[model samples]
Target chain A: MSTSRELTRCKTFIPGFDLISNGGLPAGRTTLVSGGPGSAKTILAAQFLAEGIRNASQPGCFVTFEEQPADIRRNLASFGWNIEKWEDENKWIFVDGSLHPKDEPVMVGDYDLGGLMARVNHAVRTINAQRVSLDSIGAMLVQFGMPVVIRRELYRVAWQLREMDVTSIITAEHTGQAEAPVEEYVADNVIILRNTLEEEKRRRTLEILKFRGASHLKGEFPFTISEDSGIILLPLSSIELRQKSSDKRITSGISELDAMCGGGFYRDSVVLVSGATGTGKTLTATQFLAALGEDERGLLFAFEESRDQLYRNALGWGVDFPSLEAAGRLRIVSEYPEVAAPEDHLLRIKKQIEDFQPTRTAVDSLSALERISTVRTFREFVLALTSYLKDKQIAGVFTSTTPSLLGGSTVTEAHISSVTDSIILLRYVEAFGEMRRGITVLKMRGSQHDRNIREYSIDSGGMHIGEPFRGISGILSGQFTHSTSSELQTLHRMFENDDEES
Target chain B: MCKDFLGNHVMLEIIDVLQRPDEAENEKILATPTLIRQSPGPARRLVGDLGEPDRLIQLLGLQDHIRPRQ
Candidate 1:
């Protein structure tokens, strides 16, 4: 009879990579890092090995098939990594695995990887290396033409590394066409790096395609390669850590809009208010914030308007900004389009979220966020921000301006529609020879809401949602085409006549 | 109607009963998660997940008396 015993798995909390990976790379296994030229494949591999040596105090070996030891040492020295010092301390080993000049060519029948295996074994045995990185398996693949021989050699290398309890990272250059060969199947993990040109700008991305013996997050994580940090992987998923809070309602000060949002905004729901320019989008958002009173904290990130101008316009709407500011419940951050990047805006909002911990947040127009990058990047930015808000359980209101009031449902503000939990569309409708406002709830996930277009108006007292149009067609198109049915017209006249007689 | 150990009054009032006796014989009779206001005036029921205390109070017409905990 065999007794079941629990095995404890060791985890490394690598500084930059750990957070994105949920922890460090899986230990005691093989991880394949594949990418094209200038895709940071070598840098990423070195990051894993260097991080292990520095942070975890685990010795690692770097086996290079392309670069010489002197060049590799010199290149890494610029990144502030003292490879010689670590080598002298016996904590690191850099082995040159390139093809030698005097090495004799072998026949197809008796191909041998015994020499390469012996070198790897020696490095592991001498340094007690816990991590081993083969820099360019592509070069090795070119040298060994036969698939069967290459596969056998790789399998043997992986088996020996496993037996010696070494976590190996094997890197290969992707041909920018098909997937890498045999590595995904033979190795325990596979990570693919891609550099795509979006809107004439280059965007670098990293994706963990496969990881055996463990459950991994499946998504393309955007990353950057810099001189300061070799490779920084930004997890596509938002930070999920948030403090739980009691549920409470914050009013929009507009009674009609409140009814549309199921009695104002819920504790942590994200409300996206989209409309055209000069349609009072910012005013509506400010009115919502102003209704929170002098006690509850509310923050606004305005990308279009200046802070002074926003305050003045908000003051025109009868909002008490001075009192709200004095009470420390209201804060507005104005940013210009030229000075800020999407990451800068995200980081600033993240810092504010950490500092104020506001119950409510309003981004006065996602239009600027859309202009900062391509549609995909903008989508990611919105997703990351929404994820942050959802994790915090904070009720957020995002305002965006559309190019046309009667345009198609396709929003010009990137792909923000899908990321938003609820979409409140406000547009100017032409009726009775006057332009009137109409509000409609496009979609609200996880909750039931009214789906009818309600006529709304804004004045001194704020916005008011009135009855829906009864005798109109094409309400969403702003201009309604009313049918002139003689019978209905006579019935209306009859009712008016009866009222006059009474 | 009965009282729990917390000294709060609880009830399983089925206003529209049209079924068999066995169907209603369960010890814990289930109803919609609704808050029935019977204190100030005419009774009213507010339904759905009442996660927001302030919205619940306003919906129940008890915003004047129900003070939120800071």
Candidate 2:
């Protein structure tokens, strides 16, 4: 709102879209939407108008050249958009440019979009529409079979829309992944939606290719089309690292572990519990979630185990998950990671956390989800979930199952180690030919923590962190070399001499 | 063709897209020599050359409006 002012933007009100677009599409201008077949380009265009009507109470016009108006009404109805009712209410209008099979127009000479333009103009005028969507301009391109003329006509149409002062979207088909359609030059703004199958998993992303006079977040942001909510973006890169740090500490439920973490973890920090199979990572997460105070609530996204299995496991560790849940202090959502895509899972998890208003959350074994996604997708998922929890100021404990049972890191830890505030490594230690479990505070941010690898035992009463392992070396590297007490004394002397020199 | 079909009875309104672009745009008159029934209960349109008088009349449902050329 200054003398040297930027173009006022028209907010689409699509979830996460406005945020990434830096306050929505440039107002009073047309933005070309390009994507491949089935990339939801039409949906995005229609949603530009639908969201305008539903959220801003702004009337909109839909000019379809590909699908008939009847089919559009029915197809978009699944999104809970009552187009017919909106049309009657004068909130939405459609200018049908779709040619019928029985009455295909005879092209004798030069032509223009004059008819389509007039219809759209009348439709907009009738409703005083603020938004317009021209879906799949590729159809018009095919109908004319002249890219030059079509592009020129489209430029005229875009200019006409600007004259109407309606912020609009014109969707065109992107022929391939690498090909840029010539029609994109019709508008100053461009957005591309991609639905790609990476590593046998479907991943959808939306990227703002160019904004002529506007600023926006760059790069492809992962998005998902929910059953009810259409397209939702996980704009993790937009999350600022500005969460206020809390000095208040909360226990890990295990006192020795708390002492090792220097009087417990920060109230709103994320902890990663990494372990191999049978190393009690879930137990660690359960303990972290179970330590919730009376007023505090915990939400557990159990990915590796079901509700009954988690309950039984917690019961075996002397924690009554059922009663805690019944008392409304805790909520557990256990599901198989294969049920949904990573983006969908993030949405569902975020929804659950929002609905429950939890003070802390534990996603037991995030490694389960890694199997269903590519490395990059899995990393983004973790980063997104971690940032969400941090932004909410909710403490989170996510367990990552390491592939190697004896010791060694996992792809999950490799990806998400920097995102989390602390990493609690659980390992299987071999001592005197006996399989013993060990726990260590690998790293803690902004806190003093014990560096010793302590022995821990899981029993009916749960895990107990005992003293640090003695006369052992290379436990972290999965190599167990036991040393005699005399050799340990020599090693202590060597450290003692080095300490004296320092 | 339309003159041969039913000449003096049908009133013709001609629009050159070059001349009245706004009116052409408003009426969606894209092609040259396009014919439209403006006052009919439902508007009927034919784009390009209106070939074959009988077929054009049938296509436009102009039987009632047609009288033997006066």
**Candidate 1 DockQ category?**
incorrect
- Residue B63: error of model 2 in Å? 16
Poorly placed runs, candidate 2 (over 4 Å): A1-5, B4-6, B9-33, B36-70
What is candidate 2's CA lDDT for residue A292?
Answer: 84
Looking at candidate 2, what is the lDDT of residue A464? 96
List runs of model 1 lying over 4 Å from the truth.
A1-26, A50-59, A62-128, A138-159, A178-188, A211-221, A224-247, A253-255, A291-296, A306-312, A318-352, A371-381, A412-421, A441-473, A482-502, B1-70
lDDT of 1 by residue, A1-502 (tens): 1212222122443333555554556667777887888888777777777777777898889888777678888888776778899999998887676644433232223344545566666777778998898888777766545656666677777778888888888887777776556666666678888887667666778877776655556777777654554665556464554535435666776876767666666677777888877667787888878877555688888888898888788777778776787778888878875465564467668778889878788998788778777776777678778878877888888988777775334353347666666788887777777777778877765556677788876665556789875566576655477656875688799999999999
Q: Candidate 2 residues A1-502, lDDT tens each?
A: 5524777899999889999998999999999988888898888888888889899999999888889889999988888889899999999987776765644554444566666666677778889999999987788766656677778888898999999999999998886656577766546899988888787777788999999978889999998887776777788777778888899899888889999999998898999999889889889888887888879999999888889999999999999999999999999998989999888899999999889999989998798999898888888889899988998999999888888888888998898888899999999999898999899999999999999999999998889989899988888888989999999899889999999999
Deviation (Å) of A405 in candidate 2: 1.3
Number of the top TM-score candidate = 2
The residue pairs found clashing in candidate 1 are none
TM-score of each: 0.63, 0.90
